[model samples]
Target: MTELVATTPGLLPLPDWAKGELSDLKGHQKSDLIDGTEGEAVTEAYDRVRAEELDWQTEAGLDRVVGGQARWDDNIAHPLSMADAVDTRGIVRYYDNNNFYREPVVVGELTATGDVAAELDATAEALDDGAGDLQAVLPGPYSLADLATDEQYGDEAAFLDAVADFLVDEVEQFPDVATLFLLEPSLVENPPEAGIDERAGAAIDRVATATEADVVCHTYWGAVPEKPYAHLMDADLDAVGFDFVSDHEANLYNITEYGTTDDIALGLVDGQNTRVEGVETVRERVEWVGEQIPAQSFDTTYLTANTELFYLPVNRAREKLAVLARAAAGEEEVTA
Candidate 1:
């Protein structure tokens, strides 16, 4: 029996009211700082925002909704930057996106930053009291190394090894998490300098082996480059997510040439674009993907947006999730 699950890569926009609420909460945090309080306001705001996003995901009928990444301060690396060994720098442009994050500078020996797990647990606890399965998103080691400045570790492989080990340790802490998505956009955007793809695969293997949840290595924005694509299939992951919305052909070809038959997370919806895709259009694309792959390659399929839906307005993002849910459930297709 094939199980169809609909979920996102885990960043959803806040509703209009919550957006206003978040601004007010930020102001409150500033006032608390001036008053010399402990700054619980920010934590409170994150919890509230997370619950709201969970409600939206449930309302949209997402079978396996993520925590929605409400704790992401700027880019996906925000929580990682707050680790004990990391020195946070000023705002830096993330990729070519308008989003900005304080650069995570590795100042000492790499270790688990308790912030990521704590936030995940909080969000998971919140979702436990709600309607959807709990999920956590972790930044991939390759992407983390790419986004950071390694002030301590001189050798690139050594640094990447440290990053992967730390992530493996982090994932081990989430025993109850239903799913874990490792965002590895860097592999597609900037392939490793050289001789690093093997390390990348090892790192993924460490985490995937250590975790109890369904682990997925989700690469987006483009096709996985030939370098990393060469060895990524051997990693112990439950599913490899491909961003069909961006470059479906190359992704499918990579699967046929370099990958084995495995469960797959099909990324058919466009998260960065404003235009909402119709239910029928997305289903057609999913079918097209099936024709491109070996007939028995997938037993379980995750219907998802290509990346975070934070780029869209809250209402539009919710609509997209709803359409994905509709398609995955084999309901009548609505007019992309």
Candidate 2:
């Protein structure tokens, strides 16, 4: 029988305590500081927040654990924005949402900066081996390219390939993780241009092969158009995730018509909303997907948020995680 796992796609909301701590630390800073004592204090805050986030996942009975991305202020493009080869331009609206992130623009030859690996390593050390089946998250190559402007590499395909290679180098430095979730929202938010899908899939596949961990290419905000969906299926990913909570009728149709990998993720929880869903409601969503593509067909199924949980209040995000765990465990009697 297939196993049901409850996990998040990463970028969870920060707890109130962490926010206060960060505020206090910022008060002590001089000149936009992130070095010396100021930097150390921020790192300490992040470590504490990550440890608590892991505890939240474990206490909620989630099978897979993520570090909650407590240090990410720029959302999915954080690592690339930190790279020396890249420079960020004016803030842009993140997809169709109110949230915004600095759009990364390539200025020089793209290269790995090891920033992501350092953060992951720090998180792992903070978790102290307590994060069971730990996972790491990264911005998918196609989305990274889509979200970024290419000033160095003139050709679109060349720029995408460079971004993929940069990610591969970054992934190579990561501490051993069970799974890697590549958030590729642009695939759904901004559909690939004509004849770009195959190259996009190839770039993703190249990055997937860079690490030993199982890779999941998770797209959200909307469903992938049919042509891109077919090309996405060619990527060497352990599972491909789709958002089933918002505007997802097309997602169901795509899976039923074109099929998916044996291992898959269904984003049934609304990560951006404040309203919490009951376990039964989540179960019904899973059952609905099962009706379209029988549950027996997949080896492993991940129940996750439709997108990052950072948009919601901290308490609500925690409640959502608990709800996901309950649904995955088939426990209908949920409290608050």
Candidate 3:
């Protein structure tokens, strides 16, 4: 198994040329825009931004590259929009802060137009073409079901299974891409009122079983449920990502134990906050973890606790985060 890894948390600002009318929408005041009026124009912009972000990650010395999620509205909304399986009642918060509401779009039956595969391929091609490593991000099945309206699914378990199958189908489309398939199960941190652990586990299992890509299940926003980690262990995934900013001690304990099985995508940088971490502090943290696990037992990645693109201006965020990554890698000296 390959060793020593670092990552920037997923999602980056869409370039001006890709955003289109997505910016005109009431809540998307901070989106990037594509230059042309046509749909193809919008897609081309997405492709360009994806390629650029992958390049940035590679230049920053990141081992695994994320598509930067330039093609989606928000992180969770991307898969929901693709599945067409939710009804946004125009009152839904675009993010947790209630800054903007989704304009109440109805999710129709699930369909795969192969657009996702094309998007993934375009990103993979960009990375390969540039000789950069790349990874793809997907909204997890439970997260999708949690975001969808209860009225639409009737039974969340069944709905999650269907979405998982859809995700599996999409993932299989990119077999040769030497990238980890990252599943963002943001909703798992705060499950729906009607959700059960078993059902969510089953949904995740479906995706795990169907796709051959190395999987990295990520649960951001808060602490991950123990059951999900156990479920992931049972499945065929290659690693699990956890947010350490909020509960570092607990997460560190979890990683010390189960982290042996999979590479640990340790989110040391706080995505929600703009306060940059110092090099010495970050190095000490990484060294502490290294002492617990052999260099081979677990690998670490530097990432923001959440999507830095959502909170900070892109360039500033990238600059600050690059420092944090350098700190974690022991590449730079700590200053007073």
Candidate 4:
């Protein structure tokens, strides 16, 4: 059987303590909390949060673990907002969830203000060998463009290109990253207007080529429009991920037309759903995807949750994560 690595697209839900710590830091700076820790630090917030998450992921038998995205303030766009060219606006609802993020606005030419990888770099150093390789996540250029308002760039095409260029540099700063998950929920959630598919494809390719690590473009939320779906294969991605829970049939059906020589990461676990799925049920879905798209068509695979685990309660999210590991490993006789 093929070994499918189990991982997430990062942006993990804050553990109980981390949530409170973040609350205190809210409308404040992370720098203020550092000195105020005095030595105790209540686990120093994110440092502790990421450490705990790493410990849990290692214990759960995952093959790859994200750095917990502890430093991210708003759905992967937080770090980008810190740049001088981008303006941070009022809180806005992210997708269909109650969670909110400060909107990123393009006010001028986007530039990298600080090292985005610093926290993850420290987290990686703190992890034991048992913790799997650290995979970094970023909001896809097209999606980031859609999520943010463009005040400088007049046209959508230019804005998309600029965001992609900025992300190419941002992702390159991720030190020792093994895999990069370019999260693009907007592509499937709110498809772009017609005729921009080519630019979208280029946007994806730009960020992908910035680093040597295998880049995977993961789309979620619903069936992506056929226009953009058809264009994905032409992009320079090492793998393409599909949200099996949202509309697996359409995702599978569409991929066959613009098939790839790359690997296909299938998001089998439902991140938004509260109900836990058994290992066997998830395994069956994984098998179904394989039959739909022959194993020979792709080089390797990844089995992951359909979206960020933030939608579910922390405990429930972690439980589902373990199940993903079990299903990917083809384990049987799992217990609740």
Candidate 5:
């Protein structure tokens, strides 16, 4: 008998205590908060919380377990650890919504490989010994290019290629450790108006071909252009992630076009907002998407559009996700 698999969107929450600890560590240098917790105490706290989050996911019957991103200063810096050119700015902003602020460092060059691979290795080692569904998250090449300063890289294309090369190296090194390599292109919301560039496509292709692991390209926070979608379809990727919580109509259109060939990670859970969605609401959205493609053509995985770890209060965030889990199990209905 064939087994049916459902993915629940997961949250990345920082415990209240952890936040307090971070605050204490920041004392006078609040700006350096994001890059401040790289030492022993912070690492230990992160490990404990990450393990707890994974356990929560397992108990909730979630198909995949993210490392909870507990150790990351921010999403962008988490993957850029191997790079030598980047430096900590000691201060970070949410970049959107005029919400909470984050202390993330700026990337100095595209040629360096940050500590992403090491972080993934550590995270993989921390999960249950036989866990088969572990995933590592990364920022997309184009987005990294956009975030880099003009002083860092004279030619954006060349710099992007360098970052892509490093990504390919990282992907190839940990083929057996993770189930999926998730790439988040936050900048895709504002890509170059002309079209998808060759260098970007090539970088994605390189990583896809090098890793036996499934590659999922995720674009959230806004709409992705047709040219990039076209380019992604031609690349050697296994799936594409779309945020239903954000621009559903545009994402739906993209899914309709390429869902049959590529696996789809449906982001039903809102990552940035505090409101919890009911099962019925999520189910309706899933059902609508299911109608567009065969069940096997896509896999529904719940993910907050961005990291909930940074935005929501920890306890409230967990309670909200608890509702999502119940919904995924068909135990509750989304209230109007």
Candidate 6:
């Protein structure tokens, strides 16, 4: 029997209370010199938000929940930006969205900063004693290279290779978790140059294989082009996520023609939109995909938003999680 699981691409909108807490903390820091207490306060606020976000997912009946990446102000690039090799430069719009991140410019040879492993340990500590199966999120090699300003690595392939190797080092240190969502928006937003798709796939495979947890190479904004989709299928990923909410016709065609992994993530809900989807609506979308791909079968079908939920308000993001859980479990509405 195929298992239907509910999850997300990981980042979620910060709640109003958390925003207030951060604001107060920042104000305190501005008034005082750079002190350990100020940093601790910021971390304390993030911890609170992370725990609350996990609780939200748990309450919604999600099978595998993320820490919600509440501390990630720079979105997918945050983990790598923490490294000494990267420098924060001018702001760049994240995809076509209004969201922006301080562009991470590669200034030196890349290195694993150990931030991801520390974050994982912290997430484990934030857990409410055996309540939720933790999940981690990271920017995939392709997107990281594509999005960043490559000042260090002179060659394109070398830059991509370095980023992949850096990620592999980071992944190798990961404490076992339920899932690892490797966000690769560039595969859909801006695909690699011709004949380079296989190299990209190999890079992704290296990172995916380094971890024991199930890795989902999630692409969003639109469907991955046919050639890249074919190459992605060659990777060692457990599941390949597609944005069914945007340009899903292309996504459906790719799946039917090229086929995907035995386990797949159907991004059936709109992550950026405030309009929350209902159980039946999402279920119908899943059913439709199944109907279209009758020749192919999935061992596990993950119900998720097409992109990160940070674009929506916290309440709406929470509602989206509930809808995904409800749809997967065949529940018409949320239950007390």
How well does each candidate superpose onto the true structure, as a TM-score?
0.92, 0.94, 0.79, 0.92, 0.80, 0.95
Q: Of the candidates numbered 4 and 6, which has the greater TM-score value?
A: 6
* Model 5 alpha-carbon miss at residue 308, Å: 5.3
Tens digits of lDDT, candidate 6, 1-336: 668989989888888888888978878786431221237788778878877888888888787888788877788888767778888788999889898998888999998977778778887887775455888889999998887888998988888999999999998788879899999999988998776788899999999999889889999888899898899999999999989898889998888888889899989889988998888999999898888888877899999999999889888888889999999888987554
Clashes of each: 2, 0, 10, 0, 19, 0
| Model 5 Cα lDDT, one tens digit per residue, 1-336 | 122233332337677677777656546444444353355555566777877777766655455567676665555544554355555444444446554223323356444343555556766777785443777666666665555444455666666676677666666666364345445454355565343355566667776676776666766775566666666667777667777777778877766664424355666767667776666676677677676555454443443333333466655555545555555556664232
Question: Which candidate's TM-score is highest?
Answer: 6
lDDT of 5 at 53: 73
TM accuracy, model 2: 0.94
lDDT of 3 by residue, 1-336 (tens): 225455655677655545554444423322322211125545555667777777666656556667777656645556555444444445465447533434324355665545567766776667654444566667677776565564544565666776777777776775354445455545445653434565666677677666665666676666565655555556555666666666766666666665535456666666667676665666676666667656455543434344435565566556555655566456775232
Q: For residues 14-104, could you state the per-residue lDDT of candidate 4 as single tens digits?
A: 7887777667665365564333222235346667888888887887778788778766667767666767777777999998878889898
lDDT (C-alpha) at residue 218 in model 6: 94
Query: What is the model-wide C-alpha lDDT for candidate 1?
Result: 0.80
Candidate 5, residue 96: how far the Cα is off, in Å:
2.3
RMSD of 4: 2.9
Give me the runs in candidate 4 sitting further than 4 Å from their true place: 27-43
lDDT of 3: 0.58
lDDT of 3 at 226: 62
Error of 3 at 156 (Å): 1.9
Which lDDT values do the candidates have, in the order given?
0.80, 0.85, 0.58, 0.79, 0.58, 0.86
TM-score of decoy 3: 0.79
Clashes of 6: 0
